[model samples]
Target: MSLPSPSPFPPPSPSAAFRPPRLLALAGPTAAGKTDASLALAREFDAEIVSVDSALVYRGMDIGTAKPTAQQLAAVPHHLVDIRDPAQPYSAAEFVADATIRVAQIQARGRLALLVGGTMLYFKALFDGLDEMPAADPDVRARLEREAADRGWPALHAELAAVDPRTAARLAPHDSQRIQRALEVYRSAGRPLSEFQQGRPGRGLRPAALLSLEPGNRGWLHERIARRFDAMLQAGFLDEVRALRARGDLHPGLPSMRCVGYRQAWEALDAGWTPAMLRERGIAATRQLAKRQLTWLRSMERRTVACDGPDPVGDLLQAAREVLR
Candidate 1:
């Protein structure tokens, strides 16, 4: 797809004799038009794109992750996308480290760094920085995994809600890795995961302009979610999952597989789900993911521009350019 032309606005003029490192971060729910908005803004500012998406980091998972087309990637350089295999795991800490390096490199060259994607946790990590939480304990992880296997993740989620409701509220019931890690952190550290985050200073990563796109109407977002999933199905999303399954190294429990579409498709394929059921489940899971992303967006302390219109890319970029000014 051809990229939209760069915006009419000029790049932010340097304010002082000295210039601070400034990055642009675009965040929103699925199908909220973040990708296109970032592309337009990146072009306007001559910026390199750095993906903050979790699933997009994995290779061979393009359509399901809604990754940019090859044409678009070639149009604008993007960092931290498709950098990992499905068998490997990635985390917010890793994203912070990598994004810090990328941002610094872009600044050294005097180009803007535009961080874009729907992964809120990575954004939080980059902004406020992670607390020095206790390291993972194998015993705690194993125990929680055993409990999850025996009693289901929902039950464990409930237990976490009782203990660390703040963290539990942010995580979905099916988010096994986070749930397990949260529980492990609490068990090992003798403090709730949320408690550890209290009053931690940022890691001094470059300052960034934050823009969040939220649909004005829930119905509209739901419709978009359904339509996008159908498009993915037409694009052979199931076949992509099947290929991953046949790889013999990747598993459903892997973080990469637990991404919304891939997770549902993996389960559906095993249970002999009908095409209709697969489509329904895929759309529903996407809606849930969007809901979670929106919730995370709301909890952010940084003020954001509300994106509510037929053309959110236009609205978001207009607001983002003002931030640059």
Candidate 2:
């Protein structure tokens, strides 16, 4: 991984009135109304949105990623959405560089920048900065891919356990992509990723406030996830997956392919599963994702302002105003 260079431009003048850009990060699980709430707050503050989503960055991945529509995007200036091709790899370090430039531009124009999405790793990269880890070698990855094909992910996971037992312990046995990457990184860099993360210096992208949209009812959010998966199917999510698969770039074990809906879609394509089965599996995967997201939010040091009602837009805007003040 490449370490980000320091900003080339000089810092803003040190006038007492000079306000560094205020980033209001709206974060939460999938189907949490983040897009709706962020748009509302953008309108209220005349702010531009810089997406913090990992999946939404890919082009032609709109419906499944729950990306905002073109009309919605036209309503407000949004950055970092639909910015990369499906085959392109986007790292958190790259996001920080792109978003930092956009945020600075927004500040230069005297407008607020609202950072919104569910990708926690991106947020951490922006605030804490990334370690100067080694670059990935395609040859190494190809070799690992061949190994994984010959001997399944479980065997690879066992290999990782021997090399990086601490990392393997935390990851699920089926999390092949992460496990593979971890092992690859350790072998390539000759350093444990866990060890590199310890004692890193800070580069502050800390927001004036970090708010998560926690709906009052967990069941309501779960129902929302189920409904969203159904909507994705109606919107041709499987067709999108088929197109991606046709590219011969669909690495089933890769993180991108293993995303909630994509995993189920891949299973459907491979097993000749029915549409209903696909839908059921996708919904279950989304619920699991939501559960993990909720667990992450709970672990945050920031106290999220919970919204009690269905329409969280009003509460989000009010919270933004309070934070800005």
Candidate 3:
């Protein structure tokens, strides 16, 4: 995959003293109120938005993604949303390339680039430079596919364990896609995928501040996740999935269909699941997504804002102004 070049202009360092911020990342779990907080920051700083979401890239996935409404989107210029059809894949590498351009353009216009979303991998790839790895080898992939057909993905996962234990440990035994890629890298390059992942974290796009919104109490977040999923159901999330399904081109394996709510809804439609069952499954999947996102948030350097509190956006504004002078 192609990479974006190093930025010509240096970004502001988070540790530097009071001045205008060139960029800010307002990241949090799903339904943590990042939208309002990011908008507040953007308007205050005369910034434009660059969404850091995986799902928001798709054209027909608005409600399930909790994408900004017409009014919210019209209020400020946004980039990177509705740029891809649901059938096409949008990789983290692509996000880095796209976001790099958007940030440069925003700054060129004397506007801050306010990144907002829970898609941690995109954020990581953009801020920390991506490491170079071997490209996909069709022959190698075909051989691996034949091997998986004969022995199953778990067995292949065991082979990956022998070569790249770190990558294997994180992957489930049946995670065929990631397992295939890791093994393909090992066989093609004779180097473990973990080696590439660790070799370079990438050049930092030093923001004026990196604000992480998380609740001190995990339960509070869980409650919010539950309520939000219920609201989605009430707001015609199932009918949205039905519309996608009616298209007949999408499938469960596609990344777009595999998103939290859409995944459950697709299975429900296929199996004729009761609404209760669909709701339960969707809520559970969303909670797991939030948990994984929180784990990623903790690894990066950022100021923590308690999003569960009554005045999360207000708290975020205070924290932002402190560094974004």
Of 1 and 3, which scores higher on TM-score?
1
TM-score against truth, every candidate: 0.90, 0.86, 0.85
TM-score of 3: 0.85
lDDT of 2 by residue, 24-112 (tens): 68888899888888889899888999999888888878788998999999999999998887777787778989999999898788898
lDDT of each: 0.82, 0.77, 0.82
TM-score (C-alpha) between model 1 and the true structure:
0.90
Clashes of each: 0, 1, 2
Q: Model 3: per-residue lDDT, tens digit, 1-325?
A: 0121233335546675445768878889988888888888888888899999999999989889999998999998989999999998787778888998999999999888998899987787777766777877879988998999999989999999999998887666766667888998999999998776652443757666668888777899888888888988899999999999899899876778878799889889889999999989888878877877888787766667777777888788887777566
Best by TM-score: 1
